[model samples]
Target chain A: MLSVESLSCRYGGVVALRQISLTIAAGEFVALIGANGAGKTTLLRAISGLTPPYEGRVIFNGQPIERASCAQIVRAGIAHCPEERKIWPHITVQEHLRLGAFGRKDTKEVARDIDRVYAIFPKVLERRKQVCGTLSGGEQQMVAIGRALMSRPKLLMLDEPNLGLAPLVVEQVIDVIRAIHRDGTSILMVEQSAALALPHADRAFVLENGSIAKQGRARDLLQDPDVKRAYLGEEKQGRLIQDPLAKDPLATTR
Target chain B: MLDLLPQFVFNGLLIGMSYALVAIGMTMIFGIMNIANFAHGEFYMLGGCITYFIAAKLNAPYLVAVPVSVAVVTGLGFLLERVVFRQLRLKSAMSSVLATIGLGLILQNGALIFFGPQPQAIPTSFSAFPLQLGPIFTTEARLFAVAVTAATLVLMYVFLNHTLYGTAMRATFQQTEAAALVAIPIDRMRGITFALGAGLAALGGALLGAIFFVQPAMGATESLKAFIVVILGGLGSIPGSIVGGIFLGVAESLGTVVSSAYKDAIGFVLVIIIMLYRPDGLFKKS
Candidate 1:
């Protein structure tokens, strides 16, 4: 239930996003794959109202959110777990989850949602009292996802969820993303790792130079010769889908 | 002669608590909103002026005057946040510095024109009585300021740690963008912070007016003391502000006994020495 129409954004002299249009129905897991400087993160930032768009509009649940404040956009049911896992250093793990539900008024429902988040990431539950700054990279990613879940958003936008993590940790995070999608939250995940994301995403869009290069069923995109050659490296040619434990798609052509 | 050491220490601590009261709000503003708030001292002056107007001019009771002063300054602070500080937030860092300095000058001069240049005392109810705790001697006014400061600080600590809004405030301070994702109204949180800081500063001014004197220029000295306290504690650190205030107070008191002429210099000396060893302030690691 999210519609982004002809959205364009610029950072001073550079055009970060140009007339990009996309949509996500309720309960769909969508992935946006791209190389560095492909404007994947910028698209997410524009939709979340963190960056003002120079053209076009964003509609969520049939209401225009192009001019809304970042907080208002969140209240309207889109939670963005941004890049670098920007968790407050001094806050405890439990407090991070609590903040995720800051928009809600019902304490009982909020508490239940927190339990739901913890169920998805038990490591976060174990580190309830520990400050987030002390958490490991994977655990921090868990906290970021858990924090997004606390918002109970209709759509969750994740930027580089698998970045800078150990292989084992990446697998676990991918599993958590799958579990979250299975539980009925629409996800728009941006990743350089097409190998990890395409397998989990129901549909995918390949972004290049601030525009969509390809969009289709994830299964078809994985088998496409161009996508495979460009995104899924040659060394792991046949092993892309065969090995569920394959290493993440390397940052191709960075 | 040694028995008097406790007396000096106690006095230092009492004044230190007053400094803490003013510094608490300043630190919170800096922590969450990243505003140095040069006009913070003007809010203190406004509080004292309001109290003087209520208690002395209108002949109201001290109890009635104190809360009214705090409420008035708090409203003013909220207005400032909405009308001025919020806009400054989008501009460069120098905008906040310039806006606050300009606001401080306006408020200070406005007070000077309205209240005149003469120092006015609130004629506190507690000023008539002096309290003695064993060998230590103190006025009831000083005790009231210390007790209220301690109680307010403890309440602030609880609010920051225990409440949902408090947790949100802490989150906003740490990561503004993340806080927004959770639907914490960033602007609203900042306004609330501004109001609270102003209220605390007003309370300090009202209480200090009873012990010291209230003039248009009083905020200058008090805000300077608060700056010293904030720097000594560490910028944007609550615990740091408290410890720094007490340290400055004790140092000044002890230094005064040695040389009253150099008593004021004690805080500056301590700040310099503390910064040399721990540039982040005494309380914060960095």
Candidate 2:
């Protein structure tokens, strides 16, 4: 339902996404795996119209959207759950969900959809009135995803959904993602962790230095010797490693 | 001296409400647009000038003129936001600051040319007779100003807390990028916010124009007081601006007991003390 052809994006003199192309069919779960600064975020930003592309086209359901504003792109049925969760510190979780549907005119369906989101994340329902800043990282991540679902998009683009999340929490989030995919919404997820994403994706594209290095079925890429050596082997070594500074202690205080 | 204290406090409350009205608008513009909006005072000046023209020149009633003036200033605000502020949105904050300051100068001078330097008073139906309330006394116009300001404040609180647009505005204030991601028409929101802020300032000017004289140069002092209130209350905090405005007004009113010449200086001194100790102001947004 979405196609990006030979898209290129630049930041000042530096090229962030260079001649990249990808596609996702209806109900497909695609994973874009890349290292830090590999232009994964930039590609998503370009698609969502946050960053204007220097060249190429982004066609959503056969309509060219590279020139559309971020708001227009969202109205065209593409929801981008941006990096770092981007939760407003003082806004409540329920308000975040309502904000996700800001452009929709169906007040009745919007209210129903908010309840639907809560059903998907019961923890979010419990803290609907509480501000997001007070929530745990895992709860915040759930609220972010729930907020994205509030848009009722045809294509949901998730950028680093598992970033800074604990292993157990990551598993729960991935499971929820799988359930959502099973319910028939297309997802294009960007992840630095190949092993975490590949197992759940139908297809995968390995990105390197702003270009696509590999693209195929997820299972084939999982067994590819080079892919195994670079992504999976690294995962095995640091399976227990957790960045202590990922969660700020003072975040809740603010 | 003690008997006169209540009267001083009552006078302070009257002026403080006006300050609060202006400061709230300033704070809202700063919070959402990320612009200090040096031209904010111009909106207030235009509010009073427009009211004067409609009421005094056109022979319209004061009540009819106030809303008309607010609507006119609000329309002007939206036009300026579209033509001037939209272009400066992508530019640096310093550029916006300079642009607004220049805009303020042009507006001030424009008003000077149009209205001239003569001060004008809005003809109100309120009686000039002072009403004694136990140990305190105040004129009808002053009472009307306070009543209108308090009602405006309550209305503002309800609009902001209970409305969808207000929630979206608050969300935009906290996270612009996230707000856009959710398809909130952020540009439109900014324009509306700028207009709303302008309308608010105009309301203050209209109400106060009845109590005090409306001159082309009145905005400068009003703008200065707004800045002091914003800083004293904490930059983007609405409640802070309200409390800070009253504090400044009361302090300045009480300062007249010692020396009326130094009344304006009192707000500056309080602001200096606030900056030294609580740089974030009294109510930092949580």
RMSD per prediction, one decimal?
3.0, 3.5
True contacts kept of each: 0.88, 0.84
Each candidate's B-chain TM-score, in sequence, is: 0.96, 0.97
Query: How many Å off is the CA of A58 in candidate 1?
Result: 1.1
lDDT of 1 at B269: 84
Each prediction's DockQ against the real complex:
0.79, 0.78
**How do the residues B135-200 of candidate 1 rate in per-residue lDDT, one tens digit apiece?**
988888888888888899899999999998898998888899888877888889999999999999
lDDT of 1 by residue, A1-254 (tens): 99999999999878999899999999999999988889999999999988989899899999999999887888889999999899998899999988888888888998998888888888889999999999999999999999988878889999998777777788898888888888888999998867778988889999999999999999999998878876786556532323344454343222
> Which window of ten consecutive residues has the lowest lDDT sum in model 2 chain A?
A245-254
How do all models score by TM-score? 0.94, 0.94
